[model samples]
Target: MLTLTENASTIVKTLAAQAPGSDDTGLRISSTNEEHTAFSVGVADAPEPMDLVVESEGARVFLEPGAAVALDDKVLDATLDDRGSVSFAIGLAE
Candidate 1:
């Protein structure tokens, strides 16, 4: 299963709270290709059929089946750069 770091959960929760109608919204992760190498993240009001729901730090995440398979055992982390930009990092779980 895909996991979110403390920072990632915090960032996602903050973003969701700022969006309109976010009470039911979750960060959705999906792949654009069959290979599942290319992925995108966005706020979704609900999970698609067969999607996996992951919850951490009060934040919800919906993972498409393909993305779930590709990201299994991986950790998603959020970081703020010196330039005041936020970015996400994915890697093997520690």
Candidate 2:
């Protein structure tokens, strides 16, 4: 199932507040390129549904449809020991 960590929720809340006239917002993560590889983030009034968790700087992230197929049942994690890095392990589908 998709999960958002405390830090991730904070980031999302902060970004949502930054949008003009947007009182409610969620991370709009989507896949890009025909390679079906790569993702991007932006503030949106709505966040696509998914069942994955992405960890970055102690924050958890959720993916939208465009990114779900590639990320389905994936456990993503990120760290900042020296530089920023994101890694993941694929999980079996339910």
Per-model TM values vs. the true structure: 0.88, 0.52
lDDT of 1 by residue, 1-94 (tens): 8899999999888777877774778888998899998889987887888999999989888999999999989998988779967687789987
Which of the numbered candidates is closest to the native, going by highest lDDT? 1
RMSD of each: 1.6, 6.2
Model 1 lDDT, full chain set: 0.87
Candidate 1 backbone clash number: 0
Global lDDT of each model?
A: 0.87, 0.51
Question: Residue-wise lDDT of candidate 2 within 1-94, one digit each (tens)?
Answer: 4444444455555555667744334455677765547877665664445633454443335566657676655443323335533323233434
Count clashing residue pairs in model 2. 0
